[model samples]
Target: MSLAHLVPAAVALVLSAAPAMAQEAPRWSFAIHGGAGVIERESLTAEQDAAYRAALKQALDAGSAVLASGGAALDAVQAAIQVMEDDPLFNAGRGAVFTAAGRNELDAAVMNGTDLTAGAVAGLTTTRHPIAAARAVMERSPHVMLIGQGADSFAASVGLEQVDPSFFFTERRWQGLERALRQQNLPIPERPAGAPGPQAANDLPAPPLNERKFGTVGAVALDAQGRLAAGTSTGGMTAKRWGRVGDVPVIGAGTYASNRDGCAVSATGDGEYYIRASVARDICSRIHAGASGQIAGQAEVDDALSLGGSGGVIVMDLQGQPAFAMTTSGMYRGAVSSSEPARVAIYGDEVLRP
Candidate 1:
């Protein structure tokens, strides 16, 4: 063969190998949040701060390990959130706050970006892992959400593990509830208030209530196939009453994922404001409209703050870019990507690099 023929063969060989190299080096990333609120450095003890950092790093490692091993984004998100759910440090799953009646009711949701399908469970009292039940609702049941006894029933029928309600009890959450009730000057209820009929044993506090700690947990990820997924879980606000449900189980409010838009988001904050703003979906929409992940996230959060909402969000784009923004004092957040080292931050001053 002449030199010209040899040159053409070499170029063809290089072209054939390029796609394989790209496929093997898939860009993936993961991010998670324990919650967002008035987390002040002066308020937290060194021991408490260390514990939270360690837990955040552990969750980041769990999810990133899944992505590093070529797992699906949905799996990575679920895995990371499950860790937070199981940890008593966050206001989800095992550490859920108590209702006015001092009972634990949990809520969770999960979304798949590939199809935009979602599942959620709300007001669950006995399910072991509400996030897993949410996934079951997405994968097995035909419904997008299940609540209260119905949700618990569906979770049991689906073979999800059930635990005694005591499993969710934690001293810190109990104290929070007590403090909220004291602040409102309302007596602790002997039982959860029933549907409106007659006055309850204790009068419910009026609206314009004091701010309570919102400890919702969430995770978002972009996987090897460039797919996105998001999940969120919470025990709702301390001293929540009347079987209240939050954005944690509301699609597009607390959780959103869109491969088409190249974004996935999970939010933690005031559930009502988040739902009103459609914060998670709005972030994805902004990103689709050509804003970078950081810009989109911060913009949506700014809007929420304008409406008197307080909280934080963690977002991941298809390009493996991650951003976390909050209107509150701080957010318990962390992230990891194929191109960057793991990072965790609590205060606004602790900036995370891309």
Candidate 2:
């Protein structure tokens, strides 16, 4: 029911799969990404790296709980994104980056590989959980995409939580805006009306410039029924202008999944390049063409890099195999499956014992 109870249930699931149980019981696979970019090892303090790892593990645990109960891959994807959205560590809902206008505009998308149903929203301002709104659009509305004020309105009409725009503010993101504006030699816009006053970062210090990376959050999963799902959410690039929309809500580009293709993928990096490369769909298509999930992930990353784009992808196959590929020096990532426990890593050099 509650997020706090999720991990324990997942543990019970693993326990139930012991020798006492039938070997035919299905196993699940899941993986999540915070973002991708030039995250060099020396850039992060031990504390910041640990904080990111913890947030990722918590998200993985939430998704594991859903899949543990044989839930749809779509539900697990949504569940994982919701946790990251609420956390201010990654740039999705609460920790979203600010636009040139000094406001948070969020974007999110979700797809059901089982039926090819998908929903997405961009330029959202007041919806507390953009991932939930994306799901609501897929399950309730006739349209596949919604944007700006109409999107928030649609979310509210569906009984999703609506919060004051100020609720999304965090000192860390504000500091990021300052850095981006200064770099571009542009004057900072006045903080929007109703925005919270600047506050101390004693609790969670704003990541230093090099440590910030890209901050988009995403997940891909394989559920017990052999279906796939993928979801991605982000606040867009810091100091973004003219309502710039990224690949996150554009389907196939940043997030794509398909049972028929035998893979689901979520990607993060430079949105424009990913859009051009069609990173997520390209990975799934390669997998469909009989490449192993690992090879597909690497090939997609290589393709994106060839286009002068940087980022990463989480690829999970129908058989519950996981592969992660990134052109960036580091990517915040983690995974859990029926055969292995949850493990998280931030820097690219950290070897994960999968």
- Per-prediction TM-score to the true structure, in the order listed: 0.86, 0.90
> Could you give candidate 1's per-residue lDDT for residues 1-354 as a string of tens digits?
111222232233223222243443338888889888777787577877888888899999999999999999989888988899888888899878888888989999999999999999999998989999999999998899999989999999989899878777665666567778998898875433332223321221211222365778999998888889999999998888898888889999889998898899999888888899999999999999999777678778778656775777888887776777776667788888786667787766566432
Residue 35 lDDT (model 1) = 88
Q: Whole-model lDDT, candidate 1?
A: 0.80
* Candidate that would win on lDDT: 2
- Superpose all Cα atoms of candidate 1 onto the true structure and report the RMSD in Å to 1 decimal: 12.6
Q: How well is each residue in 1-354 modelled by candidate 2, as lDDT tens digits?
A: 112222233223223322233344338888889987777667777888778888898999999999988888888889999999999988999889899788999999999998999999999999999999999999999999999999999999999999998888887888888888899898898876776677644437765544233889999998877888999999989999999998999999999989999888888888898888888899988999999777777777676757675677888887776767776667788888877788777766555432
Model 1 clash number: 0
Off by over 4 Å in 2: 1-26, 209-213
